[model samples]
Target: MSRFTRTQKILMCLIGFFLALGLLFQGMRQASIGDIGYSVLSYLKYGLIDYPLTSIKNFASDFSNLWKVQEENDYLKEQLSMTENYQALYENAQREKRELQELLNMNESLSDFNIISATVIGRDVSYWNDQITLNVGSNDGIQEDMIVVNSQGVVGKVHKVQDSTCIVKLLTCEDKSNKVAVRINFQNEDTGEDAQSEETDSASRAESVEGILESYDADEGAYVVSLLDEQEVEEGMRVVTSGKGGVYPSGLFVGTVKKVESLENQLGQVIYVEPLSNFQYFDYVSVIEVN
Candidate 1:
């Protein structure tokens, strides 16, 4: 046979080299394909598909929990609002209860007197001329000069009256027309005199130490009681109406003696009286109708 050409010989050697190389790597290529195929199939079944399903289930559970939390918050808000309303109502009830109790006590104390209850509606604008207006008026038998009193002591006298309202001049009034006849009450020792006596005699016997409720001392915040006679007056002594002028009834409490001093250009002592009623805060009063 003719000698093979140079190009043909080179092509045959290249093909033989590739054939040997392929045989040497044939086991490795098969093993790699088996492992890669198993890994790709597992990823498609579990990693690609099951991962999204698990995430969806978790999202649904979280959303349900969020709704439950929102509902609980709303319930708490409603309960808090109800609690606030109950607290306000309880406070109002307590205040009303105290006011009612005070009115009951006042009624029991002044049971013997002929009086009509009235509510204070207004107060004077001036501090010097202390005055208060009441709801009761002439229609309710409330007349001018009628004595007004509270549970503690005397409040004032009715100054003006209308069909449905009346104005009262308080004890703190600086006017001379507001003077009240009062007396210091003393414990009378039984002298074995006849107990049964005329009404006029009993009235005279009731007055022990007499004085005039004249003026109010603004500096001392007390009413000035000018004694009609020279008598021993001490601090803490009780003073009441004497009924000498027939305006206020006898035995109506006026005030207590806070201090005593010598009068200027007068014979008797000047007794300073602190009124029993709180003039600044009284709400209710009684208008007296003398029997």
Candidate 2:
């Protein structure tokens, strides 16, 4: 009923033929054309609308997982910091325990003597005249002339005392008044034995070779023993306080003989002694109150 060119009419007929063929094929397969159209519409709706909604849900789930992971990382860092702090505290406690044990052992060794424990506070700046300051003073029963000793050996004598602190004149003091009566402990010459002999026999037969500690030589780093008895003194001999003058207690360790020299005209032997007390290292000492 419409006016059209011949070519246009021919194209319209061809389209109608293909559409009829598609409907006929669908009917043979027992599927209606309307059902086919509805299936196509559902596929398009899923691609445009449902698929985007599913993608958004997946994105939200990924974001939540990422946030949880970050929180866990932060928590682990905090725990690591706490662990390091605890480790440092544990090490410090162990060091303190060792120091206390050493102090206790030293106290036990001096159980027979009346002692007042004190800590070294400082040292004299002069190298020639060695001295140390103690934290105890007259308030702690400390007084001048009190003998100061440690686990190793005698340290010095209290020189001056204050209300809370005191100064000790070390055996190395370069003063003649600081002399101490010392004796060399030698093995029994009659038995012809060495230092490995029995304790009782050695003690009974031991001869005390007397000497006077005069002064320290800063250049030689040793104490000079003057007025030594005319005895057979040797190197490596143990020296101790003889308690002759009543200033220092008997049997307090002094040092060991490093060398012995003959005096001119055979007056006496000059013995050089290395002190047992290590002035550079000792931190705690006991002031003996001889009863």
Candidate 3:
């Protein structure tokens, strides 16, 4: 045989090299496929060619899932917070509604009176007396000396008024003075020159028949009824507004009498009064607005 040419020899060597590499790669692929692996070995064979691309793809998918989960969590948390806030607001509104309804019921019970419901805005008992402030003012048609009443009884008169606030004097306050009539029904002793006990019924009747004089002194009685001279009031009787001055309306309930003093020249009487307004525990009140 003639000596092989240089080009031919080069071609032959290249073909042999390719043949060996093909066999080696095929054998390796068969061995990898035979091994038991879920996705690792298969990815290594196919994914190694563009390793960075495959890795980026996997990283992106994982990042997307994590982002979706975070967004869902944030939304759920926001919803829970809003739910709590709405529940609290609802409860507060219900409480306010109940209070308003009760106040309205009190307004309907008054006889012969026009009611103007107002809220208590400010209160100070410092200077004049136990005086409170109301939200009604001149613009709301509130005037001076208007009678204010609560569920229990009377509050006081309007002392001062601004555009949106008014000062109300309390009944038992130091500065405020009220005059009322009262009555007391108590059992004590009878006044007497002619007073007869139950035991001396027949004797007393026989004496009276003889004209021995049955003179009973009103002053000698243990309990007596008299006018409250200082307060211009009477004991053991209903104390109402005599309507002496134009200040208060007539027949408004002022208070009830507790006691009276007996005196000679004047109607001797002292009165213990229970104010109609329970100021100690009053929350709502009404002002009479006569049109």
* Best by the TM-score measure: 1
- Candidate 1 residue 177 Cα shift, in angstroms, is 1.7
* Per-residue alpha-carbon lDDT of candidate 3 for residues 1-291, written as tens digits (9 for 90 to 100): 759898999999999999999999999998887775756777777777678787899999999999999999999999999999999999877755765675676567655677878887766545333678888889888888788876645567787889987888766554323432223222224556544455365443321100000111223321122332233333434344444445655545555554545555854344444445344545567898644
**Model 3 residue 273 lDDT?**
47
Segments of candidate 1 deviating more than 4 angstroms: 1-103, 125-129, 186-208, 264-267
Stretches of candidate 2 above 4 Å error? 1-109, 127-129, 188-206
Q: Write out the backbone clash pairs for model 1.
A: none
When 2 and 3 are scored with TM-score, the better candidate is 2
What's the TM-score of every candidate structure? 0.61, 0.60, 0.44
Point out the higher-scoring one by lDDT: 1 or 3: 1
User: 18-51 in candidate 2: lDDT tens per residue?
Assistant: 9999888878777666788899999999999999
Residue 250, model 2: Cα distance from true site in angstroms: 0.3
RMSD of 1: 9.8
Query: In angstroms, how far off is 181's CA in candidate 1?
Result: 1.1
Off by over 4 Å in 3: 1-106, 109-112, 125-129, 176-238, 263-267
lDDT, model 1? 0.81
Better of 2 and 3 by lDDT: 2
**How many residue pairs clash (N, CA or C atoms closer than 3 angstroms) in each of the candidate models, in the order given?**
0, 0, 13
Expressed as tens digits, the lDDT of each residue in 110-219 for candidate 1 is: 67767788888887566534889899998998888888887566778898999999998888887877788999865543344454444456667544688999988878
